[model samples]
Target: MAIEIKNTQENFWSSDFGKEYTDRNSRDTRDWDKFYLDTYGVTKTTINEKILGNLPKDAKILEVGCNTGMQLVGLQKMGFTNLYGVELQPYAVEQAKKYTQNINIIQGSGFELPFKDNYFDLVCTNGVLIHIAPENHHGFMSEIVRCSKKYITGFEYFIEGDVESVNYRGNEGFLWKADFCSIYKKTFPNLDVIQKDFYPYITDKNLIDCMFLLEKK
Candidate 1:
């Protein structure tokens, strides 16, 4: 018999088994925040500076999992206004709105974003791709392509497995199977993979694996 994953008020925006796993591990969100700030948070800001350098000023950017508007601060310094964020965490969405201006922080899922097609000049996220379920990876990636008018950047775990496990300090979960780069290439054939890397921006020195920067065709 197939094990069923039911949605609930706790994990309203998640897919099958997501609610149970996410709720079963409430500290995951807190640890997730810490991991980013520790690993690749500052590096990500520097990388985006180089990648987005000399791009059109006032480029509209959308962040798929903008937790509390941290990256928006970096983009603001980069002279890219017109920022938007979609987050599953209700608290994170609310806090994000408090810090940023002209930001559209929506409480929505990445798999089904509440935005029009091709609506942004750039779409980016840090440590977001691994959280989504394997079956839903295609849809989420397609949505990013559909909404992006210029570029897409993503940072995620690069482990190879039909189903892999990710451990954040004490929090752990099964990572839905999907290749980080393949999904982008397969979904948006026109887009070019501009940058890719794996490094230790974390305390453990091996927590984060994959990072990508793609330009729209």
Candidate 2:
């Protein structure tokens, strides 16, 4: 029988498996300071200079799996006023609220977003989509695109073709890699790739990811 992926994901992220992450991040052990994505080295400065330039200071942005709200905090500091985040894990949501400001943190799943259509100027995920099962990708993608008025972004592990399973802390099928760019391009014909960049993870040299920025036509 197929595993209930949502239940499995909820269990993994709400417990110590997820708490440890938020805890570590709070203590400065996780380097998610500023608009720079920790461990992976993707930064707002770098991204603005390279791919997406001239982001409005007051644009509405939402992060799909904003674990500890670090990225949201970073964006606020960078001058973005209206910011929002949705996190499935309760502990993470609590921690994010405790730490960040000017951002609405909601406890919800990506498959069924609670926001209205074209609500956010930019909608994104940082290393979050990899955890979703392939079958559920269509569901999540549709909601992400629907909520975003102009831009959709994914900074995630790159898989050229098929879904590849990742072994995480003795867990199997919890993580998978896919070419997010290809998937987005194929899914929405009106969306055009604005920028694409790749780099290796600092924590683990073997792990690599691609940052994709797509503009809705």
Candidate 3:
């Protein structure tokens, strides 16, 4: 049997695989415009009307593990002025800055976000929580909530029950899927699920992407 290693955000995202992830969207303007929408159907309008319509346009927002900052770019185009992001990959950070302007896209880890408690109006993680190891999920989630003042949002893969590992490129225990909304309410009892939405990709039949908007009570 092979020894299963836990890949932290700090380590795996700094590796070449992470760089390869960003290289997919870099060096092309047209490719960057509708990247999130064309790929995941997650558009600036989807985020605005569905997830964050309640909040003001000037709300301070932070995206943890904002890969290439395309999502942040989408939010920016939606009239959101206060946008911020933390990316573990250096190449992703460089690419993000080059791709979008007037946004604070810093290089950092999701394990320990470098921000004061209750700093942002909404703290978000898009497709980020699914990658964290199950055991470390609590710490990561706690840090995310710690940095947010009002809301916490997650646009992630959804499964029915507990965290289940999935193989990524023949590597096991890297990607995961679970009921994140339930987990979030369980993890933080005071937080309530304000809204939730689900979307299945047109290209893939079985996979469902879920987004949950959670509010601290």
List the candidates' TM-scores in order: 0.74, 0.86, 0.90
Error of 2 at 194 (Å): 1.2
Q: Which residue runs does candidate 2 get wrong by more than 4 Å?
A: 1-7, 27-30, 33-45
How well is each residue in 26-107 modelled by candidate 2, as lDDT tens digits? 6332354442566656665565445445788788889998987876776676667888998887788888767787789988
- Candidate 1 Cα lDDT to native: 0.67
The parts of candidate 3 lying over 4 Å away from their true place are: 1-9, 25-44
Q: Which ten residues in a row have the lowest lDDT in candidate 3?
A: 1-10
Model number with the top TM-score = 3
lDDT of each: 0.67, 0.79, 0.81
| Cα misplacement distance, residue 163 of candidate 2 (Å) | 2.0
lDDT by residue for model 1 over 93-140, one digit each (tens)? Answer: 555655667767777767676788889988887667776666666777
Candidate 3 per-residue lDDT, tens place, 8-55, comes to 544665788778867864544446546646656765466557888768
> Which pairs clash in the backbone of model 2?
none
Ranking by TM-score: 3, 2, 1
Give candidate 1 misplaced runs (Cα > 4 Å).
1-42, 160-163, 168-179
The TM-score of predicted model 3 comes to 0.90
Q: Tell me the lDDT of model 2 at 161.
A: 73
